[model samples]
Target: MEDAEIIRLVLAGHHEQYAGLVQRYQEPLILFLRRILNSEEDSFDCAQEAFLAAYRNLNRYSKEYPFRAWLYAIARNKALDLMRKRHREVLSIPDETMVDQRPNPEEVVLAKEETALLSEVLHELPEQYGQALYLRYRQELSYKEIAMVLQVPVSSVKTYIHRGKEKLRQILERREIRGGKGQPIMEEIISR
Candidate 1:
């Protein structure tokens, strides 16, 4: 069923139907929060709180906005609240170590290393830039949906993504130059 229809059912007092929404979004929501919070436990906690908040505020939900975007907005707020409490600024990428299902060990190792490098590079970016890039590329959220989640203008979202990609390219170039010499990317970034 469509999200709107499920929402209508939920609002019509079929509370058990709410589990479907949770199941559909649970993994994505947790992954999104994990990028921001950099802690699996915290992301899970924040996602749970966001869902509860969303349920309580379901009456305020409008059909005009996409349900995923709305849920992400709530999740973002919850993450921000947790950040304020913990005072953390560093963000990390999604964990990609689950390679047991893949066929080749060599490919899995290479992919894990690449993911680790990308995560390190992403951690060096400004929070907004990293988040905008993640939402656009990793989460596959549309520009408008990202704007809704970030509570920014769509133009700002576009600028962020463009600049983020440019910065990422530059970082990769620097890594390519210095990486062969055993210099850590963090040292390279810090020296600049």
Candidate 2:
């Protein structure tokens, strides 16, 4: 059933209908929280909290936007709350399976080296840009959806994602030079 239909059913007193939505989004939401929180236990806890928050606030949901985007916003807020509360930084490598699963046969497979390089560069970026890029590419969310998740205007989302990609490209270019001289600079900045 479409999200709108399920939402209508849930709001109409068939609360059991909400389980389908939870089952559908929990895996992706947990993975997203894991990347942000870097702790498996915290991520799972936040995922549950996000779902509960969404359920409690479902009356405010609008079908004009995708339900997953709304769920993502709640999850993102939960992770940010934990970040502020815990004073933690450094994103652990996201699970190999965390990327979106929509089939696209022509997707280019990155070498292990390239994947590691990308992950490192992504983790190096400021949290805002990193999150915009992660939500865009990793979760395959649309620009509008990303705006919803980040609670920003669509233009800001565009600029953040554009700058994030440029920054990542610059980092990669620096690392591509001979003799591997980029390590010192990368380590210096990332160690903070």
What is the TM-score of each predicted model, taking all chains together?
0.89, 0.81
Compared with the true structure, model 1 gives a TM-score of 0.89
Task: Find the 10 residues in a row with the least total lDDT in model 2.
Answer: 183-192
**lDDT (Cα, 0-100) at 115 in candidate 1:** 62
RMSD for all candidates, in order, please. Answer: 5.2, 6.9
Residue pairs that clash (backbone atoms under 3 angstroms), model 1:
none
Displacement of residue 178 (Cα, Å) in model 1 is 12
| Candidate 1 C-alpha lDDT tens digits along 75-138 | 9999998899888775898765562478878767766776677688888788899898888767
Model 2 accuracy (lDDT, Cα)? 0.77
State the lDDT of candidate 2 residue by residue for 11-97, as single tens digits.
999999999999999887887787788888998999999999999999998888899999999998888988888887757546553
The lDDT of each candidate is 0.83, 0.77
The model with the greatest TM-score is 1
